[model samples]
Target: MKLLSVNLGTARPVPFTDHPDGVTGIDKRPADGPVRVAAPGPKGTGGSGLAGDTVCDLRHHGGADQAVYAFAREDLDAWERELGRPLANGCFGENLTTDGLDVSGALIGERWRVGSEVVLEVTSGRIPCRTFQGHLGEPGWVKRFTRKGVTGAYLRVIAPGAVQAGDPIEIVHRPGHGVTAATQFRAVTTERELLPGLLAAGDALHPEALAAARKHVARYGG
Candidate 1:
């Protein structure tokens, strides 16, 4: 129901892997803290900008597109145990780490205005890819995710501004259909064949996503 923390990342390769760069979160940062949210150098797409698009990996991998993974604030503890390291401010490999919000259940078309600066539109759910498996170092990670059904969402920047950790994330709006991020994630990843039902339930999807959903529906909806 509220913004816990806004996160961004530098595209650093895993210390010992051939995989691509990843993003993470910083915890316990104050609302007024200077949270970095975008790339400060040339983007992987050969451009330079301060937009989230500049730092996000969705543009490069075409997998977890536009999604800033939101985990339960408590998951940080679990991850610390799994990874054998202490979770730190800006260290969870997510763009945003939040509390008091069930991100897995956030509906499409939901929007949040952060501290009068950034506006986020929930577009779709985060679909796990091999990169995630690599990050977790678990071979069946993606399958476990599919079965667990706790995936988060992809959000677009409607209004860009400075954000920091511990900022109170407030919901601007919630759609009526109740097609939450978890349902959308499953529909897109597990039942990718049933995309129109999902898209139809979304209230404010971006043009590209809308078009893709329409095309998929046309192709699979028979």
Candidate 2:
């Protein structure tokens, strides 16, 4: 699909902010069409255009779980409206922002290619936490996310490579299992009964989540 924004944190290790604390590069502008390259910005440390891994923390501070937020192409507008500003200077807090891809509905275990370098596998849904509330300055941000089921997806790197903002995204696989991001979120938060169905999803199941699902299935036996 189309590339929206490419974000990276700087290595300064300053206190976290509404934007990425250590933004090294940005790609919110597209060239030669809708596709844009999110290469290293002039402010970057090495100018290599590659953000070192681990800058993106999924489960650690962002939420209750390990991974948080795989953004979709459409949500960009909504986020802008909510934030009351344009997304630049690492404000969205997402490593890669894409357009024309329905990441909200992406199935767990699906893999997407970023250019020729990196692979992003859908692992889980972002469960809103207090941090999100603080960022949005809304008391009900988490509740809103739960009710809307618009929580972004969580992706793990299958491969690492340099990525820029305008890079085209290609879908490498459409998971055989039918489990979607909404289903996985329900399993984690509300419908404990759906846990078994998620495990039976087989290879389409994320490995990190598989262990818990199997353990639950052993007890639930649906």
Candidate 3:
């Protein structure tokens, strides 16, 4: 697989966002040169891992587990066919637009070596929220997206380094688990019964997701 483009965004007022500030960093555009990728901190404290990218809502966005968001070009094309509109590389607010990658099918904890140095692990799937629905301005978008169940993967930076457009993505590691990003998305969203099963992913599960799964197991005896 290859990185089609490295995108970054700046904070700006979004007309329909859920944030009190009415601001969002969803307007990502491809950037030139190698961008530094590192853990920004925790979920509520850090923003995007890409140095110049902005994360507007600290309470709901950004953190070590969600340092980078990636989406496949093929998925975007699918959306475009359904929406009857063209979607650009970074249009979905993803930091990395990848080509020839089955991002949603990737197993949790799978590690990708980007360029020559940066390594990132699959953590979870991007959950559709009010901000995302509002950004799209499509009626029933959240429900539509949820039903599609092809949510892109959120990545945690493992080895900080520089990443650029056209970088090759090598799968250097894959956890011995069947819990894929799509599975995690369903578990947390529509398929509550599947939550406990995500524990099989172990530490590869995002902290918030792990907590949710544990809570489900405690309540439902999974």
Candidate 4:
């Protein structure tokens, strides 16, 4: 697999976002060349792992566990066909637009060696938010997206390096757990019954999600 584009976003005013500032960086555009990738500190303090891109609302977005987001161009195309509109790379505000990867199907804790040096581990699936629905101008978009179960992928930086369009991606590792990004999304979203299984991903799971899973098991009994 390979990256179709590397996208960056600039903060801009939007009436649709729930952010206190009423601004968002969801309208990302493809970058011209290599963009540096690194862990962007902690959950609330860190922003985008990309140098130029910034995450406006840290309460719901941005963190080491979600330092970078990737979406499959194939999935975008599918959405384009369904929506009867043109969907460009980075339209989903993903940092990396991958051409051939099944991002949602990737197992949590799966490690990918991007380009040559950058390594990213899959941590979770992105949840559709009001900002995303408003940006897309799609009513009931959140439910539709959740129903589709193709919520892209959030990754944690494992090895810092630079990435750009056309860079090759290598699947360097896959944990023993079969819990996929989609499964994790479903567990926390529509299907609470699946929450107990997410423990198989162990520490590799996103901290927030891991905590939720533990809470679910404790309350409901695995």
**Tens-place lDDT digits, model 3, residues 1-222:** 999999999989978887889899998999999999999998778988999999999898899999999999999999999999999989889999999999999999999999999999999999988778887788988999999999999999999999999999999998888999999999999999999999999988999999999999998889
Lowest-scoring 10 consecutive residues by lDDT in candidate 1? Answer: 22-31
lDDT of 4 by residue, 1-222 (tens): 999999999999999999999999999999998999999999999999998997999998998999999999999999999999999899899999997799999999999999999999999999999999999999999999999999899999999999999999999999988999999999999998999999999999999889999999999899
Cα RMSD of predicted structure 3 = 0.8
All models: lDDT? 0.57, 0.58, 0.94, 0.95
Among the numbered candidates, top lDDT falls to 4
- The true-versus-predicted C-alpha distance at residue 145 of model 4, in Å, is 0.4
In model 4, the runs with Cα more than 4 Å from the true position are: none
Q: Which stretches of candidate 2 lie above 4 Å from their native place?
A: 10-69, 79-92
lDDT of 1 by residue, 34-83 (tens): 54333232223432122342243434332223534456566556657765
Count clashing residue pairs per candidate: 8, 15, 2, 0
RMSD (CA, Å), each prediction: 5.1, 7.0, 0.8, 0.6
Encode model 2's per-residue lDDT on 1-222: one tens digit a residue. Answer: 955655544333333233455321222222222222223222223132233423323223222122223577567678678757664523444555678888878888787888777676776776675555555465686787687777667665566565666777898988777788778878877777888888755755555456767888788686
Sort by TM-score, best first.
Answer: 4, 3, 1, 2
lDDT, candidate 4, residue 104?
Answer: 96
In model 3, which regions exceed 4 Å deviation?
none
